[model samples]
Target: MNDGPNDTTDLFFRDATDLAHLIRTGQTTSAQVVQAHLDRIAALDPAINAIVTLNEHALDEARAADAALRRARATGGGPGPEIGPLHGVPFTVKDSIDTAGVLTQRGSPIFAGRTPQTDATAVARMKAAGAILLAKTNLPEFSYSTESDNLLSGRTNNPWNLERTPGGSSGGESAAIAAGMSPIGLGTDLAISVRGPAAQTGIVALKPTHGRVPMTGVWPRVPRRDWHVGPMARTVRDLALAYSILEGPDGSDGFATTPRGVDTGVGPAPQRRLRVGWFTDSGLGPVDPQVARTVQRAAEALRGAGVDVEEVTIPALQENNPLALFNAQHVMELKPAMAEATAGHEDEMFTMSTTMLSIPDTSMADYLAAEQGFERIRDGYAEFFSRFDALLLPVLPTFAHEHGAGELTIDGQVVDATHVQTFTVQFNITGMPALSMRFGTSTDGLPIGVQVAGPWHAESTVLHVASVLESLSPVKDQHPDL
Candidate 1:
């Protein structure tokens, strides 16, 4: 509502709910809000490279939104047509999500010049809710890597420490939101894409139960059972708000037909004590002590708030490493499409995709074998959740590392850099809803986050627990100096 440059800068940091309230009350025009964000993006994006493609018609859309607001006001607060809950708020979308007439390159050189003629179901839903799309954030090529870098868009730097990575494949979205380039955005999670980057950049993100949100137009679709598209924001409430608008069955995606729905209106802490299970290690790999301690602090805080929190282990989580399963499934499903898209230009593909193409094809027998193991992981979580309302764990074994490092150290143990997904991939295999939220900071002042996973289709419970942690977190309001 404040139009002065200094006030507008602060406004950019406000969550989507606060911005929407200002616009709905007629204290600020959509045009002003959109312009302020555009200015911020223009000023900061060069350092982070978070927004790869800016929407040229954003200001025009804002003017139209202001006109709509005016018309709604003229009607004396009585709705002629329903005004969207997010009317006049600006948001960004990951490049993997299609936006009509916007370039959706998918961070692959093969898709250069690609523009979608229609919005993806998720994007359409947000637009219908009156949210404006301002740009598309970057990602790794075909979203295959945990770091957001590609030959097409270069690398996206972490807002906290430019020398380090903003974890990807959804790294750009996390960076944009954390740097105040966008208050809310969309990100995809297959393994740790959304949660990992959010953890690294000190933001909030959700990997809703697989299929809770339709994946109609996301690219390089593979591991169909594990892929998810979810919301990222500065606050748990904003994440819930976006989820409410983006969720529900779209009729086209069979995975979206679940009867459960998200409750954006999480009014207060439950009157009854909720049982929660907390663990510092998932048996996937060793966790950094700081990361582990952060989870411990979150558990202690929950216990202080009257939630019955205790340490528990899912031994079955150690039975299988899902990296092979994911690689095999992705190679089986995505190779042909990459071959077709690149055609004779195969030599120009991103290094990761190029390496992926060189890997031998996965036989049906091998893929089926992997599926059988995945079923075990899913069953393990089902059993665990049957006894506890939710499970809490660290999002990664360590904080964000120097980009392209071949190895990392966690608690004096050396680990392959690629193993960063060790703690996160199992959830993707199990199709559970997970949230990553800022909880603590590293000695170097980098942010650390913890993951909260709930039963299938239990996004509301996940958000509720995350809200409690957010309230208790020392780093909840922390941001990068940038």
Candidate 2:
């Protein structure tokens, strides 16, 4: 680790809310804040390969924020303490998301020269909250893979260890946030995109209920069956704050029927009595012994608290897993978009798309059946949550796997890498909220995370539980040694 004179890595490690507080208090100018993060990115990004695109215009935005602050200060009436809730906080998002005039290539050569004419709803929301867009992070092609890699941007390596992956498709965003390149970021989770990466990078991420946030300009996976726009940050509060800004219904998403009646700015407060269900294995995949142990420990901690904790099984998960169906739907829906994005580069697109579609296909009838299956699962979750306030599970079967490795081996058993996404994807399918927070580190120093599943539109419950766990372990402000 390069420790320079006046190193700002420590400063950069602050959560987004804390950073915003500093900016609002005039303790740190936005330009200085941007420069500090930029410096950290320059020094550490080489190893993590997290932030693929550095926004050269970020400093300009920072300067504008500073000028705006000065203007507000110059007024005879001093600037109101409440400007934007984000008030000059710096953040990033997956490259797959539209970032105004920036290249939103969806991590493929197909959109090599493509630039979004407008910002994605989440990006616009974040910016409106006074968050500065620092840069666009990398992802898997079309945000398809569980690992971040594309012909346009090589691969995003895990911050905990360079050779391993920072889970994807939001891998870059997680890696960047983990290494302190950016304090917080918005990451879409169709499957394990957000939680997987958060688990690997030791960050806190939330996949709010489906439609909790609009997916206006996000790259689609054909059919777009299970997907979500969520917040990935170094702390649970940061994730909650980011989610508050990003949540809402937009006129754009076709599948978004109605905006769940949840207030983004001020959500429902935490309840007095809490019931939590803890399960390390759901009979889906083999978990790393250490990951399981750490999660169980966290569950025990929660039980020790006033909250009620138990091991309850959701039977629907056993017979009707939507893993295959979800992937099939994603590939089918996005194939055309991917093809169009890679028009000039058909070969690359074909290769990537084929790699994605090669997974077992769930036919139209199969999809219809899967839809019914998902409804059952959703109902099961509803019933489960009626009894339990939250459910706990491992974010991934193991810590960060080797970058772009095809499969994951757990305790002498080889599980398909694609299966690692199974746990997180079900939440998207059920339109429920799920949170991933760093539980502990593996013997190799790689981070392991635990996921908290809450009922539909219950982001507050999920966040409250995560905050409790966060208070117990306190994973925030601990950036990688990068």
Whole-model Cα lDDT of every candidate shown, in order: 0.87, 0.80
Q: Taking the tens digit of each residue's C-alpha lDDT, what string does model 2 give over 1-482? A: 12222435457778888877777777777888899999988888887787877777899988988888888888745556546888777889899889888878788776787888999989998988888899999998888788888888888888778888888889999989888888899999877889989998899899887777888888774446577888998888888788777876778777666564563211335435687898877666688899889889998989887778888678878767768656655555665665565565667763456665455555788667767888888777878877877899988888888755677789779878787887788887777788999978888888889999887767888888888888888444466775
TM-score of 1: 0.95
Candidate 1, residue 293: the lDDT equals 91
Name every residue pair that clashes in candidate 2.
110-341, 110-342, 222-333, 222-334, 223-333
RMSD of each: 2.3, 3.2
Best by TM-score: 1
> How do the predictions measure up, each by TM-score?
0.95, 0.93
* Poorest lDDT segment (10 consecutive residues) of candidate 2: 1-10
